[model samples]
Target: MTMSSVEDSTQAPFVAPEIVTVGELLRRDLHIPDYQRPYKWTVRNVAQLIDDVDTFRTYGQYRLGTLILHRDARGNLNIVDGQQRFTTFCLIALYLAKHTSADVPDTSAAALPDVGLEISKANVQDNYTYVSESFGSRRGDLSHWAEFFLDSCEVVVLTVNHIDEAFQMFDSQNTRGRALYPTDLLKAFHIREMSLEHASPQLRLAMVRLWEEIPPESIHQLFSDYLYKIKRWANGQDVPQQGFSSEHVELFKGIKEADPSNEKNRWARPFLYAKNYTDDYTQENSTLIRYGALSGVEYPFQIDHPVLNGETFFLMVRHYYDLGLRCGLFQDDAGAIFDVLPELKPVLDLLDAHRRMPTHQLVRNLFDCLVLYYVDRFGEQSLDRAALMMARYAMAPRVQSKQVRRAMVNNYALGRSSARPPSTNLFQELRLATRPQEILRRVLASPELNGYPELHCLFTTEEGARR
Candidate 1:
């Protein structure tokens, strides 16, 4: 693959397996880069981690997993692998250091014993409670456990110099642990790209702040399900069965370095140097969404947006993320469509009232196709009719889907399925539906839908806020 080919050209140094205590390792600056996902250890995950450490301590010395790091332009150790354990250990160390508090937030990661970074409140409370119980809540026992955790607990450290090789190692190692989310990899790559582009310290930190501000769930859905899906359809291609993944990230990444040695794609090099002038920067607003909607920071921009550098790339990410959330919420601003939005609320409500009904996915997928078609063709002016068409089209597939072709919901309100639903292949149909009129006509005329009942009940249900 690309990783293998890159490895062949650029040999990354892999250090020998040397064991170091948590205290010894934390003595250096170890940072979980802003791109990494937040510490989201469940109470169970935290309990299991501590239990493993406590169990290992009984054996004299416990060997923790390997940690992966890449030296950045500034020469800080940007952690790539072992984030889960590393962050957990740091939090545990802080708790032992009596640094837990709600009002005071820790954002420094310099010295190990003094390293103080804020973990999520829920995780801290849950984990500290678990640790208290795990060590029997005695001062002597706690002190001994802390010492063992800091001095005896050891891990193998792998420091990679090359960014590409580091990512390769990160991905490979992730398979043996908790996999880094695709977005995590994307963030690491873009940060390196920004450094390569020689972006200013202010600009680089700005992008980092922007990335960290975005809600994780929103970005995940935005990339994998929304923007990626829409982009493929716009290009008249079938959506990949795997949805968006690392490969798609490469496509988004494009060519990082121009082939000056071989001579091709010359414009790419100059484009990377293009800077965003503040006077020309403007507030971003889209039919799908507005910039800074989530973070409250208006992102700077460039005229015509000539280059795909880190800043612009994240700008693209944020733009599509906003659009995706709006589409999912059925909050499109198609002028006259506001009149239709209130009328369409019931359909969204019914699906949600049942926790998105017989098939949670069926409802959302149906909405995706419908919203995509509406946004692409008739605009929000057609939302009311679009909702109706979606409701009817959903029933059309019921005729054939054995999974959803049931009456259990009918015991109260009949619908989709327990697992996969009737809305499977529904996007292609909605894509073809184009205009609201076309959607209404095409769905009503489907041969498979022979004699489905009227969708009057779908409209009659009491309204609810959009999902």
Candidate 2:
């Protein structure tokens, strides 16, 4: 397919951006595309938006961000961006027009008088209750609240004809530093990928629920602790230097979304050449999206992605998110798991020491990787062995030389350039190999050095690790 951009000189000019108050913008039906994430603005976000509009009373018209829209064949305004702001405004208007609370403070709780619109969701009804609490502080006459909101607040309405054009424009906005998180984009990417086939909507919605259940702060930690590093190391790649930074959002590329039954999943070619990704990057200092595409699926760019395809990627993240929460990395104290499992305390201690290091540190990454790997493979009962194996590998005399040390890891099952995980037997061998140093040598000694992170027929340096 031809790669099309909104800025293509041959393309028609976009519909001019219009300065419109909420009144005019609300005059038409608007839709959030299915690929978008649910409205995740917490009460704090809601409070900020409302506080900004409160400025309109002192100042004439408050300029919120742009409202980007694309006209679908059915004439509904498909919000390409700014869904959060647009949805909030609708909720606010509806909140004002509908309910009147006596004891509760929602002066705007009454109802939208004659806007001829309705917005609904199963869970957001409670958030609307929070909206009432927030707006109740304004406590003016309930009657005029919708009118003031519609008339006082304004947004620049940017409408374009093609959805792709709208996305390209939306893409430009996110290339800015402060826009969306990589996880947020991954949420959208998987939602869109799932929609590509006959996947269950109920199942998809369930996944969204699980994702939303994760607190925003924990999402990054889940990636840093397990998903990002484990997946990268599995694919024989290093996690980005930014180490889960927002700029590295190109973590998952969408290559081909054909029916899984009919297709072997292939990674999408990413837009790695995008200027934002390569700004300070140069040849000697850089690792890229294992960068290129095969002949069958043609696309615009390269991305270094995990070997796990879409649904598998999503499921694994969900699994590890739960794991991190259980490991005390997310929910309770970072060391709380050790309290519950006195046995795993030493394992936790070793991993905890590396928790503050950069994720790119091979020792730190592999330690975290093996803990999650062992616990995930053999269950919590195996934590002590997992800890011992990691420490043994770290302090092994073979590791004393920078060469064989890195090489042993490079030669391990994880170091292979494949998305597949290490087999059960390999883990068992690791479990058995973590003995007293002399016995460990006896157990693992051989020219072939079968099945341990032992440095025998392997490449040993960082360059070898990359190889």
Candidate 3:
């Protein structure tokens, strides 16, 4: 829970870190910055904290963890890190003050902090409910335990004036509890990147709200299952067996739009033009008569296109998240596909109804990634034909082999196979293709489908239509 610090001799006098009890720390005005990740501690996390406090009540002093604070010009202490632990402590204080006979300070007598994000608010409500029930069930006089909790539980507080220094410390500190996810690290990185543009606080808050609205698990899956695989496979690289991790984050961190060199670079022209046009059109035409038709014009985003760093990165995630929903990757009902592309229904329905063995599921993932990539590149142009092509390409391995592994899937993606000459790598083809026919023209070798009559019929009908 503790971190090592070095003192600077040339700079202004260093503010010494202080060790304060939970009660003492709660007396200060604490704030959670909008750019911080949503509170994600679960019920088990709360219960564990309570148990730890009870276990060490008689040990004189129990250090909770380190809290990094960035003190703003107005003297408000913004939580740069450890907001999760700090928030849990606040909940405990509130529960004890209302339900127990603990001599809690008057400063701690307050309502729960209003959390703006839905995910954080939900966790706070759940954790509070657990705290109330757990505290109420405790036996005998509980005032002493409460007193020990408030007075004995300690945390090392490190206060800094600059946000960058606070985050640097956060990155270096040894986290004692839940580990930060790769998504969390990405959020922090993009938020810092946005800061360089001096983005307005309201705009920053809006961006965070947009991010927090989506379920965290969905975002993780979107990156790990679809985006990561598509990026690697399109480049003719083997996808890691372990899927996406922190090492792969750099793939998403492309050129910063604000960088002078990149802004002037020829490669950034299309992205910059799209962003500017979208912004200008929305601003000018939003209240006009044609608003309905033109107001929601978005930055043209492609899955293979270079990711613009900062705000656009958030937009890119949202863009694909909505796409995933429409494609029925996150939902159970296939109705969404009917709404957007009725042509994909038969293939998607057949896949959904089939037995989902591990290998089968891998093929399913491959199909989903291809459909997503095709749509991303060409929109609805020849979408039905593109979908059939993707299905044939993705499902070939599943039908040809009874036991398909990760390597087999990867090889099939790269057009490497032993049974026949290598087929066209559809992903690579899509990356190079400007027109749908360029991809649709590539012929697929039909797989031996002895047991899968439905698939055989699907391929036969598609081939017949082509002829």
Worst 10 residues of 2 by lDDT: 110-119
TM-score of each: 0.65, 0.56, 0.87
For candidate 2, lDDT tens digit of each residue in 264-329?
322222322232233334332334423432222212121123323345445556666666555545
- Each candidate structure's count of clashing pairs: 3, 12, 0
User: lDDT of all the models against the reference?
Assistant: 0.54, 0.52, 0.76
- Residues 1-467, model 1: lDDT tens digits: 00111222344465455678777776666766644545667668878878888798878888877898776545567777777677677667766666332121132352221112244555656776876565555666676777777777798888876666677777666534436567666776776676656566556666765776666655766566555554454444555555677656665565354325424656554554332232133323342234434333343322122326466777766655554444444233341212234545656554444433554444345455446445544546657666755665454444334355223222111222332233334444445553556555542333243232333344233420120
Indicate whether candidate 1 or candidate 2 has the larger lDDT: 1
Against the hidden true structure, what lDDT does model 1 obtain? Answer: 0.54
Off by over 4 Å in 1: 1-17, 31-44, 73-75, 94-136, 175-178, 229-252, 255-309, 329-346, 358-360, 376-381, 399-443, 446-467
Error of 1 at 227 (Å): 3.7
Clashing pairs in 3: none
Candidate 1: the clashing residue pairs are 409-413, 409-414, 410-414
- Candidate 2 ranges with C-alpha deviation above 4 Å: 1-16, 33-36, 56-58, 70-75, 98-148, 159-171, 196-207, 231-241, 254-309, 323-328, 333-346, 349-366, 373-383, 391-467
Tens digit of per-residue lDDT, candidate 3, span 94-161: 87877677777554443322324567779989999998888787746567778888899999999986
RMSD of each: 9.5, 14.3, 4.5
